[model samples]
Target: METTLRKSDEHESISDGNELRHGSVVIAAITSCTNTSNPSVMIGAALLARNALEKGLKVKSFVKTSFAPGSRVVIDYLKDAGLMDYLEELGFHLVGYGCTTCIGNSGPLKNEFINDIQDKDLVVASVLSGNRNFEGRINPHTRVNYLASPPLVVAFALAGTVSINMEKEPLGTDLEGNLVFLRDVWPNSKEITKLIDKFVSTKLYTKEYSEIFKGWDLWNELKPPKEDVYQWEENSTYIREPPFFKDFPMEKPPTTDIKGARVIALLGGSVTTDHISPAGTIPLDMPAGRYLISKGIDIDNFNSFGSRRGNDEVMMRGTFGNIRIKNLLTNREGGWTSYHPTKEIMPIYDAAIKYIDSNTPLIVIAGNDYGMGSSRDWAAKGTQLLGIKAVIAESFERIHRSNLVGMGVLPLQFKEGESATSLGLTGEETFDIYGIREIEPLSELDVTARGINEEELKFKVIARLDTPIDIEYYQNGGILHTVLRNMIKK
Candidate 1:
C-alpha cells in the first residue's frame, strides 16, 4: 500500500455514517431484476417521480441517470403509466436493458464531470435502486454510493447528492428557498396502488411477454449453441467453456496437501462476491481485455464483462476485487493482489496469474456473511474461473454460498469470534485444510495457517456442505456442469 494513497473525499457506504455533500451524481439508475421485477415498487417510483415533476422539481443537470431494467417490459409499463416522461425529464433515460449500474456497465462518467470529481475531490454519491452497493460497482469516481428504492434514487437526483437523509430533511428548496420535505412529495401506498391498478395492466405481462418470448431481434441475434456442451473456442472472448468443467476429476480428494498449501490472499469482513468477481467495464488495457483483443476481438466491439459470462478467460481475469478493492495485507486501496508463495504483496489479479503460472492453487479467507446480494451465478463462476479452489469465511450469504458450491468451490465457515484477522492471518500465509473427505453439514475440519515464523496455527472451520446434493455438486465440478451431465445421461 502506498503511503501517499489519499483517502477518498467522501467515503460512505450505504449506511449513513457521515455527512454527504451536493455535487455530481455520476450514475443515478433504477435497475436490477430483483427490485424492478416487482411492479409495485416500479410503479411507486414512477408515481413519486411524477409527483415531484408536478411540484416543479427538476433533476440536477450533471446527474447521469438511466433506467436499465433487467427485462424490457418494465419500460412498457412505465410508458403505459405515462410516467416515462417524468423519469426522462429527471435524466432517468433508457439505457441498455440488462444489469447496468449494479454490474459496472455504468457506461461513461462524462469528461467534465470526471474532471470536476477528480480535481475538486468532489463528494459524490450514486443513489441506485439496485442490489449490491459495494465500492466500485457503480462508476469508479463516485465514492458514497447508496442502495435505496427507485423513488429514493429519483429523490437523490433531485436533491443532487446524499447531503441530507431523505427521511429527515427537506429534499430540496424552492425559489423562495422553502424546504421540500420527502413526506410532502412521497406518495402513500394507497395513492401508488390506485396508479398501479389504473395504469399497470395485466396485458403488458401476458401479451407483451408472449411476443417477447417468440423473440426480440436483440436476443435473436445472439448465436447460442443448440448442443448441450458449449463448443470451447480457442480464441473467442464471449463464450469459452471453463477448465473446471472440462473433464474434471470429481473422485480425487483435495490434492496438494491442504496442510502444506500456500495462502494466496487474506480478506476482510463484508467482502461481498463483487470483491470476488467484479462485474464492470473491462478496461481495454487490462489482461482480460488484452486476451480478448489477442483473440481478434475489437476493443470497440468488446462488450462489458457481465455480457461475457460464458467465457472463462474474460471472467477469470475479471475476478477478485474491482479496481477499488482494498487488500488489508498490503494496505493498498484498489485492485486485487497476487501474494507471493511466502506471502509478500503484489498486484491481486497478477498474483493469481502468478499462482497459475507456478501451478499453485488459490484460496480466499474472509469474515462473516460472505457473498451477499443477487442470485448472480457469475459471483461463484468467476471465482472458480480465477482458480480459487475453496472459500473459507466466517459465514456465507445464502445465495452466494450455494453459488460457490454450485461452482464446485468449497465453502467453509469459521467458528464464533474466529476470523482471518483475529487468527493473525495475513495474505502471505499458506493455508491448509484436511479431512475434506469427512466434511459434512456443520462438520469441523482442521485448518492450519503456516506463517513466515515457521509456526503452524491450527483451528476448526465449519464445512457448509449441508446437503447430499451439495456434496454431489462439489464432486461434479459445479452445479451447471452437474446439470449438463445429468441431462446427457437422461
Candidate 2:
C-alpha cells in the first residue's frame, strides 16, 4: 500500500517530502490516569511500540512524544516486561509522573515548527492517551486534538498526520519498503492480558506506596515558616495571599440592584470554563504573560496558568484568557473584548482592569449552556476578582451557576424562548437588574438595557439562587464571606 498524502493548495509543504501538508500530529502524549491505571492498555502500548520498532517504523522528527504514567507502578511493570526500551526508541520517553499534557502542560513545540505553524496558519493536532482534549486545553498551536488509547497515540506519532484512516491507509513504510498498517502492530487482547497478569503485582504497588509520603530532596529543602498566619512573600510570583478576604466585614452586606453594568464578554453557546479560566500555556503577549515578564521572569520560565494558579494576580488576568475564546464584543476571536468607554479593542484582562479601576460593574452575556465544560472554581473566582457582578445568559451549566453564586456573582437566566440576539443585545448597552435587594430563591427580576441613544429595552430574568443557603451566601457576598462572618461570631 502506498502512503496517502493530502496535498495543500495555498500553503507550501513544511515537511521534507511534503508528507504532513494536511495536518501534523505535533504532540503525542501518554499522560494522566484515564488509560495509565489500566495495565492492559499500558502494556498494549509498549507491545505496539516494540512491534513498530522491529519493523523499523520511526515517529516523525516533528512529533513531540512523551510518556507520563499516572503511577510509578506503571514504570515498574513496563521495566519488568522489558518493553520500556522499545517505547523510548520510538520517542515515547518518560517526561513526568502525572497530569502533563492532559492539563495543557504539553509545553512549547520546537521553535522551527512554532514559526511555521503561526506564519502559515496551519492546523495541527495532538493525540493524547489522557482524556481531556478540550479546545485550547492542549497546545495553543494544535487546534485539533483527539483522545486515543496509548497505542494509538504512538501510531499517530508514527503516522505524523491525523488526516488518514488507520483502518486502510498505511502509517509508514518499513525499512525493507514493506507497507505497515495499524493491524500489523496492534497487540492482541490475550497478549495484553497475559502481560498484565505477569508483571502487575501487589509487590510493585507496595514499593511505590511505601515511599509516597517521603519527600524528594528539593521538597525537603524548603524551610516553611512556623507562624499560624502565613508570612506572605512580597515578590513571589508562584503564590500570594488572595484578596478575597481583604476588608471583609463581620456584618453581611446588603445586596444591591446592579446598575450601569457593562458586558465583558458576549459569548455564544457551549462557552466552557476552559474559555473562562484557561489552564493552558501563557502566551507572551497576553496580560498574564506581561505581568510575569514585568516581574522579571523569562519567557521560558513563565510556566502554565495552572502552575501559577495560587497567585491571584496571574489567575485573575488569565480569566476568559483561552486562546480560542470568541468574545462577540469584538469582531475577532481570542480573549478580547471591546472596552466600551473608549470603544477600543483590547485583551479581556486589560479591559477588565480598566473597568475595575473606573468602578464600573461588569456582566457577561452569553447564549445557552454557558460555562459547560470543566467545573473549574477559578472560572468563578476570576470573575469575582474582575468585578463581574452578574452573568446573564439563556441558560447556565449547573455547577458553574452554583460556582457563580458561591463567588457572589449573580447568575441570571433570560426568559424562555428569549436570547441575546432576540432581545437585540448588541453588548454595547448599559444593563440594570432591579429587585436584587428583595430577592428570593428563583425570583423573577426586571432587566433594563439602556442603549447608546438612551433607548430602553426592558426584559425579565430569573435569579438562579436555588435555595435559602444560596440566598444567604449571596446576601453575605459569597460563601467565603459567610464563613468568615460565622467564624467571627463564633
Candidate 3:
C-alpha cells in the first residue's frame, strides 16, 4: 500500500524509502453493508466502545470516526438496547444512512489534517470494517487501509495506528497518567454473544423490510422524465445516447488476430475497477474535467465519475483517470502515462484518443489479480472503448473476466510460472496475439511480444471464455449486442 501511494501524481507525493515516517489514524469507520448487516458485530462494536469510554479511553483527536449502519433496523436495535449513546460518546456517530467511508464516499479530511499528511509524508491508516481495502478505494491519502471488524475499527480508532501491538503496548495514557492497553476495555466474546442473542429478533427484520419498497418516500415521489424510451439529452453532462448500438450495423464482428497492439498501461497486481472505472472527485486539470468544462460545466459541478457514468464521453475519458492510479510505464503516478512512439507524457485519455485516431488496437499487460476490485461492468466497457481488444495477464478475477467477454474483449491467462515481468516486458513491446480463430473456453493461444529492436519472445495464454455462451458474446462484439441480435432474430 505504501509503495503504490508514494508515487508522484497531480499533487506532489512522497518518494520511496520513507515508508516508516510518522504514523497516525486519520479515519476509523465502522461502515459497510456487510458487517452492519450482522447484528453481533454492530452490537459488539457499540459494547466495546461503551466499555472503553467508561475506562476514560478516547479515540485519537485526528481520527474521523463514523458509524453508517446497513439499514434502519440496525440503528433501531442498537438504540433499543441502549448502545447508541455509548457508541456516540466514543466518537462513532451516524454520518449517513448508506455506504459512507467505504466506496470512497468518505467525505473530506480536514485541510490541516490533509496538509499534515502531505507535508509530513505521514503514513496514515484507515481502519474500516467495510469490505474493500484496495489502494485508493478508500481515501487516497490513507495509504494503509485495514479491513477490520466493527469492534476492531473502534479499537484502532482509540489506538490510532496499526504500528502498535495493542496486546503488548499502551494505546495512550488515561486520566491518572497510567498507560492503558486494549485488554483494559476489550469486551469478551461471551458477553457480546449473550447481548446479541437477547436483543436481536426476527421480528425486527420482518417489520423493517416489510415496507421496503413503499417507504422510500423520496424515490416514490420522484417524477421521471415521463417517456417509455429515455429521451437522450445531447447537452446533459450526466448521460448521453449510448453509441455502441447506434453507430454500428447489427452484425457480429470477425474474430481477427490482434497484431501490432500497443500496451496502453502496464500495471502490477490488484488493479481495481475503481482504477479503470473511476468514481470519486474529478480534478479540473484531468481529461474528464477538461471535457466537462468544454461542455459548459464548471469544475465544482463535475460531481464524480460515478454520478456521470451514463456519459460515454466522460466515462471513456475517466478511464485510468484515478489520481492514485499507477501506470508503471511512467515512473510517476496519476492518470498520466507516456504515449508510446511519441514518448510524450500525457493524460491516459489523451493517449487513448491518439491511439484510436491512428487505428491502433490497445491491450493492457498486467501481473496477477488484474481487475480484482468491484464487479463493475464499466471496467471492461471502458477498456473496449479505449480500443483494447485483449488483456494478457498472469491471472484474472472471475466476474471481471466474464465482464471482459461481455464487452467482447478477449481475456487471456499467462501459462503457469510465467508473467510479464518473468518474460522481461517493459510495456514498450509490440504484441501480436494470434491463433484465436477457433477460440474456445480455456483453449491455449499464442502471444508474441516483439521489441523495437525486432527481438521476439513467445508465450501461451489460456482463453478465459468460461462457457460457450461467453464465446458467443465475444463473437457478437458484446453480451448486450448479442442479446439485441437474439431479440431481432426472435
Candidate 4:
C-alpha cells in the first residue's frame, strides 16, 4: 500500500512511541472537482452536514474544514436547494471555485493548531476526496491521509479520528447522550435524487463559465511590457530575466568534461519534483522566505513557491527546499548542505552561492525514481542555477530527465544494480565526470570521486541524451538558449 493511505476502520492511530494518542483530523475538506462536479455528491454532503449539525455532532475545533466547488453552478444549486446554509452552519462553507486539497491549496490551518502539533508531534491527518495524496502534499504537518467521498469527509471530521470505525464507532454524543454514527447521519438516496433533479439548471454552468476566457476585469485591464526583449532588472523580486542566454552564440557549444564537482545533495528513492523544487507554502526561515522578507515583503504576503516560478532568484533559492526533503550531504534534514571542503552548514541556496562565487561546480547523487512528481520545470532550471553540472541517479523520470537536458544539465544513469549506496558514496566526496570533450548521445562517461579520507573511487554511467537533438540542446546550454541565439541572429 502507498504510505499515504490509512484504513480509518482498522488501523490504530497511535504510534508505539509509548503514549495513547488519538488520530487528529487537522484538515477535513469537501473541496475538489472529484466530488463537487457531481450534483448528487455535493447535495449529499450538505444533507449529511445538516443532519450531523442538527444532532449536535461536533468536530475538533482545530480541524481546518472547507468546501470548494468546481464552478459557480455548485453554489447556485446548493442555494436553490436551500442546503448551502446547512453546510456552512457546520463550517463546510464555500472557500473557492477551484481545486484545493489535492494541490496543497488546503490553505493554512489555525496557528494554535500548528503550534500544538509542532510542540507535541501529534500524528495528525486529513480526510479529503482529493485525487493525490503524496506524503507532504497535504500540508506538511498532516502525516496520514484518507481519501473519502464528500460526505465521508464530513463524517471523519465529526468522528475526529482516523483510528475509529465509521460503521461501528460513535462520532459524538448528542444532548440526550445518544450515540451518533456515520450511518445515522448519512443522507438517503431518495433525498439526494430529488434535490439533484430540482436544483440543477443548465444555465448555472453556462452563465458562470462563459466569461472565463475574457478573464476577470482586473486582469483584462493589466498591461504588458512594451519591449519584445525583456528588460532585465536586477532589483525585481518577483521576476527577472534569466542569464542562461546572456552572451549566447548562434553556433553550438563544446562538449566539456566536469571535474572536481561537489555533491550538493545526496537523496534517496522516490525523490519527487516536490522534493527537488516545492511549490507549497514557504517557511519564513527558508532562504526564499528570507529573501522575500529582506525585500520588505510581509510574511503573510510572501505567497507560495508556485506563485513565483517566473522568478529565477526565488525558484533557485527554493531548489531542494521542501521541508520534508532529506539531504544526506550534511546528515541533517531539509535543504541543508555543507559548503564543499569548508564543511559550513547552511541553506542549499547559500551553499550554492558560495560555491558559484568560488567556481566550484555542483552535482547531485540520488537513488531510484528521481524527479517523479508534478513535472515542474523549475526542478531543472533551479538545479542548473545551483551550479549542478549533472545529476547521476540510479533511475530517472522521463519528463524531468528531458527538462534537465533542456536546461543544459547532463543526466546520467547508473548501470543496473549499481548506485551511490552500491559504490559507498558518502556525499562528501569531490566528483569528476570524464569523456565529455567529444561526448555523443547515449554515450558512456567515466566517473571518479575523492573522499575526505583521500580515497578515490571509479564508476561508469550512461549519458541520458537519447537523441542528437537532446545533445544539441545540452551543448547550447539548454533549449531556451538555443532559441534565443537563433532569434538574435535573425
Candidate 5:
C-alpha cells in the first residue's frame, strides 16, 4: 500500500523522493444524490478545489478520482461559476451525472495497484460523498470506506489518505515548500452562498428539464417491439423475463404444513440486504460471474449485479453472496454454506439449487435485527426463488419483513428471549411448522425441530403476516400473483 514516486521528464512537478504511505485513498468520488443534489456542498467542493489550485497543490497520481453529480444542472452551475476547471485540475473529472461509486459501480482499479495490493495484503480506503459506506459495498479491494462531504472527498484525494487528521496534518506543500493545511483551502459559508445565489437559478432548471424526455441520440435510435406480449432475448445477459409466474396455478393451493425443511444459511445479527444481495462489481470467480462467462462474456464485461438484476439467473446466483457475509454453518467467511445432504461446503447458491432439485423446502435461521439495511426487494425475491419458504429470526427489519411476506416467503419471529443461539439450535435439524393453513394476522404457530439423534425441540413462533392484505398476498402465492389473478378475473 506504499508507492514511491520517481521524477520523470514528462511530469517534473512531482518530487522524486515523495512517498505515499499506507491507507492510500484508492477511490475518491464526489458522487451520490445525498450530497450532489445540494448546491451548497457542491459549491463548497468547487471552491475548495479553486483554493487548492491557487496554493499549487495537486492530487496524488495513485488516487482514483471522479465527480458524478446527481443532476445535470449541477454541471451547468459549476461552469457558470468558473469553478469546474479547478476541480478538473485536481483530478475530480466528471464521470457521470448519477450514482457511481456509491452503488459499487466505481469500476476496476489499476492493474499495477491491484497486483501490489494483493501481493502486500494491504488495506486500502475510499472516501466518497455517499450515504452508504457498508462493508463490501464499495470496491472489493477497498477494505475501509469513509463517508465525507464533497469537499472532504477532494481533500482526501489531494492528501492521498484518510489516516491524516485534517485538523492538524498538512495535506501537501505549495511551490514555495510551504506546508498547506486543510484550513487554508476550506471554503467559508458566505462564499458558498454567494456562488449558489449567483450561479444556480430556476431558469436553468426549467431549461434542463424541458429536454429530459427527449433522450440522447443513442437512446432515440433504438426501437422497441410493438407486440402485445414482450419477446425475451435468450442470449441477452442483462435482461430476461422473470420466472415468478411461470408455474402459476389458476386455483389457489391449500396452505400445508412445512415439513422436513432444511436450513440454507445460518446468519448472525444486522444482516443487511447488501450482504444478502450485493450491488457491486461481480467477482470473476463467483457463481454469478461463472454464469456470465458461460454466456461468452469476458471478465471485463461482467457488469454489477444491480445492472443485471432484470435477469433472475444472475440475481439468484448472487443471493447471500457478499464477500464479507459470515455463514455460521461454514468455518470460513463469505457466501459459503454446508449442504446437509452431502455435508459438503459450497456456495450458498449451489446448496440452494441442490435443495431445490431434491424437491426440498429451505428456511433461513438468523439472529436479531435480520434484513436491516436498504429494503432491497431482491433480498426477498432471491430468497423465494431459492426455495426458501420461511425466514425465522429473533427480529426483522420492517420493510424487509413486508417484502418477504409480499414474495410469499413466510417471515417468522422467534418468541421473546429466544434465538438460534439461546435455544441451542445449531441449524442442523429438520424443521416442521404447523398451523400455516389456519394462519391469521399475527397468529402464533407451532414449530418442531428434529435433530439427527431423533431428539425434538419444540417452540412457537409468531407469523409476521401482520395484516389481512398480507394474508391475501401469501394465500395467492405472492402480491404479484394476487394482482395477476385479480386482473384475469376482471
Candidate 6:
C-alpha cells in the first residue's frame, strides 16, 4: 500500500528508507504540548509576534506561520492580551484545536509554496516550541525540523530560515540584503512580564476550563456501563481492558533458563517515542486502517492516532509508525517487519503479532538517548500493549524511562563503549536475562544473542530500574493500573 501525503507532490513520501527533502519550509508552526501547557510561554510567543509586527517584521512570502496552542486557555489569554490580530497579520492563523503541527497534523501546505519548495529544492525547517522533531511528523516537505521555545518559534517565523541561531545571528538580509540581527527585535524579560501581567490571568483557567470539564459532544454520546468495572468488549478494538487488569501472577517471571527468543526489531540511535509510537495520519493498509474500516470509517475519515489513544486496536497497530520508520534489519525502508527465521519482510505490527503468537518475548535495541520528548503516557502505553518486554539503549530520556517502568517494560542501558551495532545485533537474534526481578540500578543482566543461523553474540546490559517507586510501578503493571487498584482497595 503506497502512502501519499495529501498536501502536494512537492516532496516524495518516503515509503521506506530515509527520503529527505530540499524545500524552503512553508509551514512554520509553533505548537506543542510543552509550551501550550504553560500560559506564560504562549503569552510570550504572542507578545513577541506582536512586537515584531510593530517593528515592521514580516514573515517570508513562502512561509506560513501558525500557532496551535495545546490548551484552550492559551488562546483565551492571547485574545485577552490583544495580540491575536498582530499574530494573524503575521500569517499566524489558528488552524485546529488540538496537537496540530506537533503530531504532524499540519494540514495542507499551499499549492504555490509547495511548488516553490520542490522547484528550488529548499531545505525547509519547522521551528516548533514543542518537543519531538522526528523527520516526517511535521510536514513531508519539511526536510529538517528543530525544537525550540515558543518565543524562538516566533523569531524563526519572522526570520524564515534555520541557517543561523536567532539568538546571536542575523535572521536575513534587509532591503539591501544587509544582515538583520535577532537582537534588533528581541523582547526583554521585563517587557514579557508586563504583557503577562496585563493579559494572562488565573481567572482564564476558571473561565476557559470550566466549560471544558462539562464534556464534549463526543463524550456525552458514549454509552457508559452500569457497573463500576467495565465488561470486556471482545470485538471492539477501541478500548479493550488489558490482560494485566487481572491479578498479578502469584509467582515471579522466570529470570533465567529462558528458551530461544528472536529479536523483534533492530533500531538505531536517538529513536524517540515518536519512532516507537508515532501519532500521525493512519494509512489505509495498516492494521489500524482495517480496524477503522470495520467500524465504517473510511480512509479519508480516519483522523490521527493521538485522537484514538483510548482505542487499543488502533494505537497498538499504529504503534511504531504509519508509513515512515527506517528499519535496518530487513534493509527494507519504512515500517516493514523482518521475521526472525525467515528474515522476511512484513508489516511491523503483523510481525509483532507473529512473535506474540510464537510466545517470543520482544526487545528493542537502540543507541544513545532513546525515548526523548513529551510527557505523553501513550508513548509507553502503546509499546507495552505491543508486547515489547524490554528496551536496551545507551541512554534513556527521563519521562519515557519512567513511563516504560510504569508500563512494566524493563529498560536497560548499554554499558559505555557498547552499542547495539557494536554488539552485532540483527533482528534474528534471541536474548535472555538472568535474575531480572532482583535487578538493581546499573546491575548487569547477562544477555545472549543467537541469530537464526550459526552466529551468536553475548553482552551484559545495565538495568535502569532507577528507584523503589519505579520498581513498584513496574510491579503494578502501569501507573493507571496501580492508581485504579489502590482506588478499588480504598
lDDT of each: 0.73, 0.89, 0.82, 0.83, 0.88, 0.71
- Candidate 6 has its poorest 10 consecutive residues by lDDT at 14-23
* lDDT winner between candidates 4 and 6: 4
Instruction: List TM-score per model, in order.
Output: 0.80, 0.96, 0.88, 0.90, 0.94, 0.73
Model 2 has an lDDT value of 0.89
Q: Residue-wise lDDT of candidate 3 within 1-490, one digit each (tens)?
A: 1223323342433322123234567889989987799988888888888888877888777788998988888888898889999989987889877776787777778888888788886778788999887666677678778888898888878876666666676766677888877787777888878878877888888988897777577888888897889888879888798878876666776788888999999998888777777766666788888899998997757777777889999888878877678999998777888899889999988998899999999998888888887898888888899888898888898889999999999998889998888889999999998887888888899988899898998888999888899989998898889999999989
Ranking by lDDT: 2, 5, 4, 3, 1, 6
Which segments of candidate 3 are over 4 A away from where they belong? 1-21, 188-198, 296-302, 322-324, 438-448, 454-461
lDDT of 6 by residue, 1-490 (tens): 1122222444343111112234234567878766678766776677777667656677877676777777787778777768778778888778756678877787666787678667866566777776667766777667777778877777767765554444555655555655566666566778768877887777888887779768888999998889987787776645666655666643333443334655666777777677777576776786888879988887767877767776777888877763445777766656677776576788778888888888877887777778875666777877887778888888999988988998888898888899877777765667876657676665788888777675767788888888877766666666666777677778
What TM-score does model 4 achieve against the real structure? 0.90
lDDT (tens digit, per residue) of candidate 5 on 1-490: 1223223323533322134335678889999976798999999999999999999998887788999988899999999999999899988899898878988988898988888778876667899999898778889888888898999998888888766667766889998999999999999999899999999999889999999999999999999899999899988899998899897898777888899999989999999988887589887888899999999999888989889999999999989998888999999878899999889999899999989999999999998888987889899999999999999999999999999989999999999999999888999999999999999999999999999897999999999999999999999888999899999999
Q: How many residue pairs clash per model? A: 10, 1, 0, 0, 0, 8
Per-model C-alpha RMSD: 5.7, 2.3, 4.8, 3.5, 5.1, 7.2
* Distance from true location, Cα of 314 in model 5, Å: 0.6
Which of candidates 1 and 5 is the stronger one according to TM-score? Answer: 5
lDDT of 1 by residue, 1-490 (tens): 0111122544442212122233445567898878888878887788788788777777766777889887767888788778788778777788877778887877877787777677766657787888778877777777768788887788777766555555665666655667777777787899778877887777777877788668768888998879996676766667665676566543433423354454555667787767667577777766777877888888777778778877777777777747666666666766646466555555566777777777777887877778875666777877776678888888899989888988888898888988877877775677778878766666788888777787888898888888989887786777876787777778
Ranked candidates, highest TM-score first = 2, 5, 4, 3, 1, 6
- Which residue runs does candidate 4 get wrong by more than 4 Å? 1-22, 33-35, 214-235, 486-490
Q: Candidate 6: give its CA RMSD in angstroms.
A: 7.2
lDDT of 1: 0.73
lDDT of 4 by residue, 235-301 (tens): 8777778767667666776777998899999999999987887676777898998989998889989
Off by over 4 Å in 6: 1-23, 32-62, 70-83, 96-98, 110-123, 148-160, 164-238, 246-257, 322-325, 435-443, 452-455, 465-490
- The candidate scoring highest on lDDT is 2
Poorest 10 consecutive residues by lDDT, candidate 3: 12-21
